[model samples]
Target: MSCEETQEQVSLLIDAELEEPHQVALFRHLEGCCECRLFFDSMLRFSKAAKRDLEEIRLVADDILPLHGPLPVSVRAAGDGANSLPMHPSGLTGRRSHRRASEDAVGALPDRRSGWGWKRWTGLLAGGWRMPAPVAIGLALVLLVAGALVGTRISTIAGGGGPMGRDGRVVKPTVVVVCSLPEVQVLGSASRL
Candidate 1:
């Protein structure tokens, strides 16, 4: 492989995404090419630095675990189990570590579907997805009722109450009216009437 191709492959190699043959070819190129080797080292350092920035350590378990021994009544009750670590310290005044520890717990459980309890539903809802079935049904029913009421109001405004038939279209009268004096009207009206 050329030095340019090998340099391009460096990131894929670091991420473990290169196939075996390509990996061997790229390694061979890297062995001979000084510029490509330096580029690969720079990329590795950049990736490590980026990872460190993105994954800053919140409170370590050790920091809060030792503090667990001095349990106030609220904190003790909140712990639920002796083995359970207080992800948040319960006291109002004591430790500002509460926020950091809780943040750590949140960071630890990143998957939306898995580790959360009731909070998973809250996250799903907060993500702007639809509500549950029953709630959606209830909303639909409300919308349907609202639509029907508005339809009635509009029909009343548009001079409704014509004889609406089974299919809901208006039944028009078949008879035709002729315009004239009563005696003159009889001339045309008699046959039609």
Candidate 2:
């Protein structure tokens, strides 16, 4: 087989996906061709080195901070106060910790749980409680239906008139008829009437 084909087969063989017949052909070519043999060896070495490096990195990371357990008390305390940890020059570890700190600061307000007031209502809304999707949809539908009904009822009561009167009856607009004439003639006609 050509060197290019042999190289492709070598990759498939490394992945353990090459068929037995292709493997035998590749081995025969590798035995006859020195360049192909060197290519296959280098690929094997590179793969092994990469795997070894990954294992070393995983070990070092586990030693620094365990994956399963809680963080050290020092790390936890460092995140709690305004003082910055020595390891981190900035007072914040990440956006999440910063947000938590801000939330805690806001929650330090005076107690208002004893009475029903605007403060209590706002507190409930800010506490991250969420209405269920179905309930929210139902509420929207109810408001829409009620608004439509009220609008139609008011329009029917008012009819085509300008507006509803104090006694709930439609008030018709007044019609004015104007007659244009010379000023002296209009005065003379009014005097005759």
Candidate 3:
């Protein structure tokens, strides 16, 4: 690979994100090219320095951010009127802003009811993703009773009983057949024939 391509891949190499074959190619190029090797070493140092700085920042932030209360709102000057966007009250960047938004979200919900327990909860969550304890319990009971009834009916049916059986066992019915044949002609008179 060319020095330019190898230099471009420096960051990916430092981060261990380059695939194996490409990494081998880049390694070979870095070994051959003095300028690309220098570039790669410089980038490695820079990446390490950047990561160290970020860790320090995070350590300082962890110590500082929680000690301070919510930040004061910042107002922007309308230099170019079209570009005048108001600065948010959440400290400086995305992480702080997200934290601030989540903190405010609980108190920001609209309360519609006069009752205390339910209303307070609804006010905090906008009544999202909630099931009352009593309702949940009632539903559980309904399911339990339905399941029990179904189980009992299945047991009765599986015990060999038909619909007409009095006990839980099957009752077979009795069947009788009748047969008849044509009789020979009797004597014309009352005498024996």
Candidate 4:
């Protein structure tokens, strides 16, 4: 295999995912090419060092903050108050003594929700959005009504005539004749385009 091909297979080899035939070909190339052999050895060293460092880090992390198992009954029942423990994104809820009350916004709010009505309203919309179901339905209803109103035909007098009485009375026209309209042209729906 060429150098690039050998390098590409190096990861698969490290993971034990390379086929025997390909692994043999790669190993043969590594033995003949001093450059490729050095590259392969360096990669192997890097992998070993990375694993060791990660294990050390994991041990230190466990000692500093062992975020495992179920919460204590008292902390679980404490709710989201200032006195309650704050949870990390990884679900590591700290002890109450580790908490700082001033940093807790919920703890700052008064018992009455009415005091922060505007804030409460906006808070409902803050997270990854999904319009509230009621709001979505109301919007759909408004669009339907608007479409109906816009689609409704505007009424004009029949036979392009004035509102002459069917009883043959020469009465004043309640609706004006469009044919007798002045210089203006009335195109109705055709004008929309």
Candidate 5:
């Protein structure tokens, strides 16, 4: 291959990615081209220096390096930073601890021990302490309305034109009119009054 192409493939060749035949051809090209040789030497020197620099840098226990391997989940749990342990959106803790707090806030639900059965609670209640207060009050109000209607009907009948008997009881007009019908007589000529 050309000198430019040989230099371009040199880094890949050092990493052992190219086939054996291609590697031999590129190596022969590199030997003859001084410019390609200088470029390859500079790349090797830079890689060695980068490796040495990385090895010399000290990494803290909680520091998360971009290129390094991931820390274990348990190891993160023991560290101080968020990288060490799973944290909540609030930056305090995870969902498990939050769920526990909410559970504690709302107490446990009433169960069978409270004697509130599904069937009894769902049915229509007639009369009892367990009955809804609104329903009982509504029934009493209906009874009161009915009594008022009956009393009004009775008072209307008493106030209408009625006959008074000797005992001071008011008799119905229909009964008095029917009783006086037989007592009336038609006379042809009577003395002038």
Candidate 6:
């Protein structure tokens, strides 16, 4: 067997998961190959060190926590309650307390119950409006169609005659010719010398 295959089987053997035949083969390879034997030895040492470290960590964690269970009283409320928010048993503050504080600071604002206007529309946009799947699809289609119409109108107005003209005809390309007889005569005179 190759050293690579032996090393893999060594790991499985350490975990006691390798088959009997594979284990015998791995041992025979380890006996013949010095490098494979060294690799197996190092892996065994690393596995033992890892297990020891994990055990130490588990012991430390067990000592840190109370033997009985978690404390019933809130840790935040254990000290003076002067500046601390009253925490619920589940560790969340009551909504009413938050609402009261906000109301006192900002005072009462005017209620906006009017139909969809700029302010309401902007607020909905800012807050991220969630439409139904069908509504979202329909809106996307409408926007796409409007964008295409706008693009077509802009291209027509710009007079590049893109694709089709306003008359629904394919516009022909226009070419202009320039005469350079003066420069050609200068070149002909130079060539004669």
lDDT of each: 0.56, 0.58, 0.53, 0.55, 0.53, 0.56
Residue clash pairs of candidate 2: none
Models 1 onward score TM values of 0.33, 0.35, 0.34, 0.36, 0.32, 0.34
Off by over 4 Å in 4: 66-193
Worst window of 10 by summed lDDT in candidate 1: 181-190
**How well does candidate 5 score on lDDT at residue 88?**
41
Which pairs of residues collide in candidate 3?
Answer: none
Deviation of model 3 at 89, angstroms? 21
lDDT of 5 by residue, 1-193 (tens): 8777897799787676878888888889888889999988999999899876764442221133321235676644434332233454443443234344344236422342335564354333333334455654565565556556556545756787344667777554321111121122222221211
RMSD of each: 22.9, 23.3, 26.7, 20.9, 26.8, 28.7
lDDT of 5 at 60: 25
| TM-score top scorer | 4
The parts of candidate 6 lying over 4 Å away from their true place are: 66-193
Which runs in model 1 stand beyond 4 Å of their true positions?
Answer: 57-193
The residue-by-residue lDDT of candidate 1 on 1-193, one tens digit each, is 7776787788788888888989888888888889998999898899999877654543333344444457787866544443333345443223435664566455542433445555555435334444554554554465556556556545754674445667777654232223231111211111211
Candidate 6, 1-193: lDDT as tens digits: 8888888888888899999978877888888899999999999999999988975665554335332234445633342132333345554333344444445346433333434655555445334554444544555565556556556646664785545656676554322222232111111111110
- What is the per-residue lDDT of model 2 for residues 1-193, given as tens digits with 9 covering 90 to 100? 8999999999999999999989989999999999999999999999999998975664454345432226687765544443322233432233224443445446532333446765555444434334454544554465556556556645754676445667776554332223221101111111110
lDDT at position 80, candidate 3:
17
What would the per-residue lDDT of candidate 3 be over residues 62-142, giving only the tens digit for each residue? 435532235333322221122222334553332444454444335432332334676355334422435555554554465
Quote the positional error of residue 13 for candidate 1 in Å: 1.1
TM-score of 5: 0.32
The regions of model 5 sitting more than 4 angstroms off are: 59-193
